[model samples]
Target chain A: MMVSLRTKSSFLKIYSWLPILALYISVLNEFDLNYLNLEYFSFNFPFILIFFFTLKDFKHFDYFLVFIAGLFNDTVVGLPLGISSLSYLLICIAAAYIRNITIRPNPVKDWFYFLFIISLINSLNYTVLTLFFSFDLILMSYLVNVFFTFTFYIIFVSIFKYYMRGLND
Target chain B: MASSRDDFIIAIRSAFLKKSTKQKFSLLTLLSISIFVIVLSSLDLKVIKYLKVGINEIVYRSSFIVSIPENLIKNAFIQTTEYTTFFNRYKRNIIELENLKSNYVSNEIIQFENKELKELINNYALSSDKILAKIIVDHDSPFLKSIIINKGSKDKIKIGTNIYDQSYLVGRVIEVNYKTSRVLLLSDLNSNVPVTIAPQNIQAIVTGSGSDYGQIKYIQSGLSDALVDDSIVYTSGTGAIFKSGVPIGKLQSFIGGSINEYKVEFYSDFTQLKYVFAEVITKTEIIKPEEKVAENNDETNNPLNVKLKILEDELKIIEETNRKFQEENEILKNEINDLNFKVSNLNNQISSQKKTINQFDIDNQELDFLKLNLKHGHKCRRTFLNTDGFIVGTLEYKSCVLSKGANDG
Candidate 1:
């Protein structure tokens, strides 16, 4: 059965705000499965979620709520308070720019654009953390994170496309 | 070219200034806020610090609650892995337990002695009480290794408080709230511990590698050759941050190109942490006996004064021992005097008994002589029939009577 909000139940109401709710939970919980013993394995779920939903211009995905989620992410991850907020808002701005520039939405173009944006953002994150905060971060870890998040973007985007199709129905 | 530039400008302006009906804050406004928050957070203002703590308190508790399902899954995965190696782990644990048991008694003694020695070296002695804190959130993030514990200022958990997983150094509390705190695990890139490499006696800084282990950094030049594989690493208490002699990890040397690189495999596993002990230390100043005199010399921070104070302490101990020995000598002297008096009294009693026995022997001899005289009196009496008779009162008469009695018999 196709899932739509026309049924007008509490579950449907929650379904409408699922993307924002997911951003909150992801920031709060950091659903990364580190216990899988994958030493070099991590992906930024919020980055993917924020990029896709903002690029699509989903009505329930509020920018303020995204900012709040960024604050929560900073608190949970023990980064200097606003570093994650900055990184997250930067992601939003990048997605918004891409969304405005594109008339014909092509997955291939968006995918390449995402790679560039994330690279810039990750590099910015590294420089800010190291130079300003004096954080001793491994450059290689950042590189690996960028690689994994970039690779997993395609997979999550497909799933998100299905979700969007269901919600639109 | 002009049309393309205009289109680019329009897109950029739309992205920055445009807001949808559902969005409250424009992208530019939020970006500005993000930068503002970053700058404010970097400042050490009291308002920001408290604000950060408040945010941390709420966020940590929320994260803990939100993490329950994921934690359950994680625990299940861990338990599943544990079940796979149940017997092997059990066997290894048993062996480790046995080794630990044998070392435990000695370790306790050493710890007690260490407290005493520390007290001797410093005027204030630190007594630590380890409070158990449950780990509420441990995500093991790749970028930052940290955990949130369900203990904070309310539980006397302060910033810089050492966290331990069964006596092994796990981390230190970097942020403390009212009901929760954040511990920067030893595996975090930001963590730096001053450590002493044992058997080699080299001091080095062990910084987190953002991995499961630590990397040994800032060793004294030319001393890297002394470092061997499997050397014990422990906190040196330098800079007075971490408690001294706490076991941190073991050094593993990787030999490669021209210079050897070393890694520290921590004793406590950062991923497997569930509960940790937060050490709350209280320092009590030792009251010196000569403190009255030394009140004028209150420069306790000075090295020379400290040395002098240690010397005074040594002198006081020696003087106390001498006083004890003097008291014992006086008791012994009194005991000897009592023994000597008893010996003199016993000698007097022995002399009196000897005189009484001599008198009794004399009386018996006189009586025997009288009886012999009576018996022979008739034979020896100055009668004409006895030619050898003598006067009774004379000594010669007695002899003659005795001889006559013997002859008749």
Candidate 2:
């Protein structure tokens, strides 16, 4: 039952990917469940992956995963795509530092923090990206999507917990 | 040998951790490649255009493979929408029949008239090349109030085609893709039409300003005979975009006073355009001036000057007709007013005479009653006096036997 690399659960590995793949397909098909629309503020699905990677270990390799995931999300659904990679990497580093003091991987604590951190990072990214272009900021839609995604994370985490019943301590 | 074992252990741990240094390097390299792709997609609209063109080229090259599947999907969507629509209509018809069954006991005549009117309107819709297009979606956002029509460029629809329904003109086509077209309604900020008044024969341009109604401008002054209902507005065909004599709408009412330009309240119910048509006929001809100067004033003076002679005759006839109609309308209005006044005065006189006759009848009744009372009193007195005389005579007879000397005196 202990968290060890040797006896890593296959279910974790399989379920770990389902969210990222779902996000990718959803972006490609413009299929949003209306539960959580992180699209407006540009805190896309890959940011969730980056958050998980950062919390697993704050190594240089984790930073690289975060950047790659960010880059992929940016390419899939973003106006200026590379900006997301940079912003996401910066947020992941900051998140790792914050994780040292807090209950790092606790779903309730980590998900809410990730919501705020990702939103802030996206807002900064949007501001920097649209600095020259006269783009109108839709604050209400952005906030709605943020809240929806956070709620979805709560629900999805519960579902994940049920599915990982055998892995529970 | 120990260092090599340690290296192998490190590789295994990194692989398990999903963070081998080699994997990390590959991740960074992939991120750079993705960044490049993002930059390429964003900075250039040409990229999208090229991508579209590339897809189109592939589609064209492999049209035998592509078009069948594409058409099948399109047909499926169309057929499904049609089937659903038919089912809805069938349900509605059943409900209507049920209502008719219940209401037939009382309002059969009214229902029959309604049926007749619906038949007429359906006939009108069928008379032309009108397409019954369903409005799939209206851009609910205020910033974009365009409507998506069921028929699009794929249906041979083109831009600038005017849209209408049984009620009235709705809008014109602005943008057209293969399977989708955007219709900008009459209430959009950028819509205009040239309308002519049938009664006054005055022409004006109507402009839309995203309001409920459009504005009519540039009408001539002093057209006083133009009533709220008199204006029969139709397409002038001056713009050459819309055909002539298509019944756009009747003039509901006029807005501004005569000094400034006036806006007409069009009778066209634009909000409901479930079916409409774009007139395909071109009704306007371009006028050339070179043909005019050749038959100028010098030619007009000649006996066979067709232009002046026709103009003079038209002027004379128009003046006479105008004057005659003006006088007739004035006379009719005056007569109407006089009849109303006379009717009121006659009513007043009849009421007064009736009041006087009632007073006289009351006075005559009082006089007759006085005469009857006097007559009755006189008759009673007379009768009493006669009786008293009779009694006195009888007593005198008795007394006379006793005193004949007193009776002789």
Candidate 3:
């Protein structure tokens, strides 16, 4: 209920500059920046990690935020509206609810949660799309997307949280 | 309480400050994530389309690729649906063909029966000499009203052959090919047949005047006796076009002019055509008048001819008288026919009048009898009592009672 002024200002700086950075990266993403093909996963993960780290106290509204993000994806990506929305909401709510219920959180626990949430979202998205849209959502393709995104997000978010701690000091 | 209130204000300000930064970062991060997903999804879709097209092309190029188990399975699914549709169409066609075949066979049998009946009837008409030709095809030309028969020069089908179906004369063969002959029907523009007024001996050239009903032109004068529905016009075999006595058609009803050159009606049903028979030329016999005269002179020189000459002179005289007599007889016969017809009609009228007179006489006699009874003092009596006393009372009846009795009687 009581958020500090310093935390609030840091959050503002992260959110305000975040879009310009994301947009620049998106333009960069158009280039096939295969740095050993790790960028493929790193591309979407960094942005999502930044968003995920913003979930501090009001974790209940995270799925709603993810749902809005999914809508934007639905329009821009031309995917079925409900498909990505369902997957994003599933991941956000699960992460947020677990964070709320758990008494303690560690890097290992965070990584596990992150991996599970991404994989669950990707696999469910694939399955739903394949069944309803009559597309062949091969398991290998879905796994590739999930693992890369998870690895990149975990690494990036860890590094990001560390830098934020310095800013806090 | 004041310190606590100040702390509460500080708390509210801090809350707003935290939300402001978080909201900006969250919105920015979410926007970036959404764009990232969209681009990735589009790339994936393009790759999928490319892969699919490549696979299809490989399968198309190599039959071996198409024959692969997976490809074969896919093809079988597609082909089975196609085969089911084609098989249903084939089955329907087979059923329709079978139905048509049955009807065709029955129609053929009926045709055979008709042909047999025709042959039987034709045998009666030309009992001694007759020909039968099957109708192979009939190209009924509305423009020409002509029919082409299958018979040709091979079947001795010649020009001037009397082409007749089993029923009536269709036409004579005009143009003959090796296998086919064209018949100029009596209804054709350029076709004409010399038809005679039957039983009346009045002849007319029934010319085809561009219609199914022919024009009976060149009818000799003084032939008004041609009655409607009277006789069937037959070919006179004069022009050697058609054989004599081929039943062409019957005289249908016609309007006659004062000049006796009336239109002869024909009953030739040209519409119903099937088979026709053509009578061929038998011999090339040519006898001129001069040869016949020389033959007569040679025949007169014999001894039997001397006696025959006397008989011939007498025959000549008799022939002369007979010629005059025939002329007179024709006039007299015509007069007699007219008189007889009039007499028959008058007899009918007289008989009818006699019947009426007899009825009137009977009525008059009854009336007179009623008057006599009334004069004898019969008065309004409903009934007469049979009394033993004679002439005790004369019963009378009213006119109404008498009328009722008359009706009852």
For B260-312, candidate 3 gives per-residue lDDT tens digits of: 33344445555445566676655433343233445878754556755564465
What lDDT score is found at residue B389 in candidate 3?
24
TM-scores for candidates 1 onward, in order: 0.78, 0.38, 0.28
Candidate 1 local lDDT, B1-409, one digit each (tens): 9999999999888888898777898989988998999999999999999999899988998999999999999999999988999999899999999999968755655655566556776778777899999999888777888999999999888899999999899989999999999999998988999999998899999998888989988999899888888999999999988988999989887765877788999998888889999999987898753564467656555667667867876676667556665776798899999999999999999999999999999999778667878887766567677766766678887777667666767
In the predicted model 1, the residue pairs found to clash are: none
List model 1 lDDT by residue over A18-108, tens digit each.
9888889999999878888788688888999999998998888888888889899999998887788888888888898899888999998
Question: How close is chain B to the truth by TM-score, in each candidate?
Answer: 0.70, 0.37, 0.38
Candidate 1 segments whose C-alpha is farther than 4 A from its true place? A1-7, B256-259, B289-409
Go through the candidates in order and give each one's C-alpha lDDT. 0.86, 0.52, 0.54
Candidate 2: regions farther than 4 A off: A1-104, A128-133, A159-169, B1-47, B50-176, B181-285, B288-409
| DockQ-sorted candidate list, best first | 1, 2, 3
> What residue pairs clash in candidate 2, if any at all?
none
Worst 10 residues of 1 chain B by lDDT: B288-297
Enumerate clash totals for all models, in the order shown.
0, 0, 6
Q: Distance from true position, residue B260, model 1, in Å?
A: 3.6
Give the Å error, residue B103, model 1. Answer: 2.8
Stretches of candidate 3 exceeding 4 Å from the true structure: A1-169, B1-130, B225-228, B255-268, B284-409
Q: After superposition, how far is residue A2 of candidate 3 from its true place, in Å?
A: 76
